[model samples]
Target: METVSLTINGKKIVTEKGKRVLWAALENGIFIPHLCAIEENPLPFGSCRLCFVEIEGKKEPVASCTEEVTDGMIVDTRTESVLRLVRMAFKLIMSRHPIICRECPANKKCALQDISREMGFKLKPKRLPQILPDLPVDDSHSLFTYNPNLCVLCGLCVYICNEIVKEAILDFNFRGFITKVGTFKNRPLAESKCNSCLKCVEACPVGALSRK
Candidate 1:
């Protein structure tokens, strides 16, 4: 395979050409804070925006998951500006996302929680007022529950359903602040076209979709 040379955190490395920056760093044992990234998924989902990296000559840090590695690129995985943006983004996400970390089953397993801890954050709800209202949970499926309150809208479930599973049973509804992943026509999972694959539940980084 073709290769490209790049520098990440001042360490020079060579990776496959056209590979995503996040994967390149990770392939070489460099951890760039990220969520919504699964190695099996071929496409990049830049929903989390937590994998921001400062590329030299760029005015702002770009989402590493979507940005491809180019030859001679200089990347900084950790910078004050990158950390600040990540924290701010997490704060906003956590404000609307319910924080029942104490009793939550995914407390230790959640990607958001992991990133928060890595950033030296407490994972507490910030003072930012929520723009979205709480929604009812969907436990119609026999195998799992769908809790919109805990959803970070990372679209991993939807991606797995549509692309990986090829069922297209789960999808987004509404728009803007009201957007959410749901069954077609607001139907329940059991009643929808879901094939009981349980891929969506496994793809969820948080407890938004959990086994029942």
Candidate 2:
């Protein structure tokens, strides 16, 4: 494994080459908020924008969860502008998300819930439209149910399903805003040979997939 030297939060740290900025920051005792990246899982699902960081030589802020570290890299984990952007991103995520945290099974434990609280969004934004389309629910599976309306297109479900489970049961079905993760035939998740593993449900950071 190749090692790279990088500065995170003004602290010099060394990490292996190809290691993501998130890991490097973590290894250096610098915590950057994140939702989709997990230790047991190396796949960087940068759907949650909480991990945005400013690099000295980078043109734009990059998602730390996906951007790999390089030698002599300078990373800023906290800044006024970066904090503002993160707060805005958090607000946007919370706006479209259902206010089920109080009653959600994952309530206190949910990544989205924790991040929302950390960002100090005391009141939900009113700008986001509440017109959520009713998607067909799939409850035939024993382990979990599929709720498309709550999905944030994080892609963790598809990533875990395909990469970890080695089962290509879920994928994007359309393009742009219409894009949805679903079974290959567009059939209900229950009908697919999903094995009822519930890995997708575990990997999802939002209420999109859950065990009811």
Colliding residue pairs in candidate 1: none
Runs in model 2 deviating more than 4 A are 36-48, 126-131, 175-178
The TM-score of predicted model 1 comes to 0.91
List candidate 1 stretches off by more than 4 Å.
Answer: 39-43, 125-127, 130-132
Q: Write the per-residue lDDT of candidate 2 for residues 1-212, one digit (tens) a residue.
A: 77989888889898889888988887777868787676555767667788999999777788888888899999997777778778877777666566766766666666766665666554365566554445666667778877776777778888888888999999988775556778986888778888878888988877778897
lDDT of each: 0.84, 0.77
lDDT of 1: 0.84
Q: Pick the candidate with the highest lDDT.
A: 1
lDDT of 2: 0.77
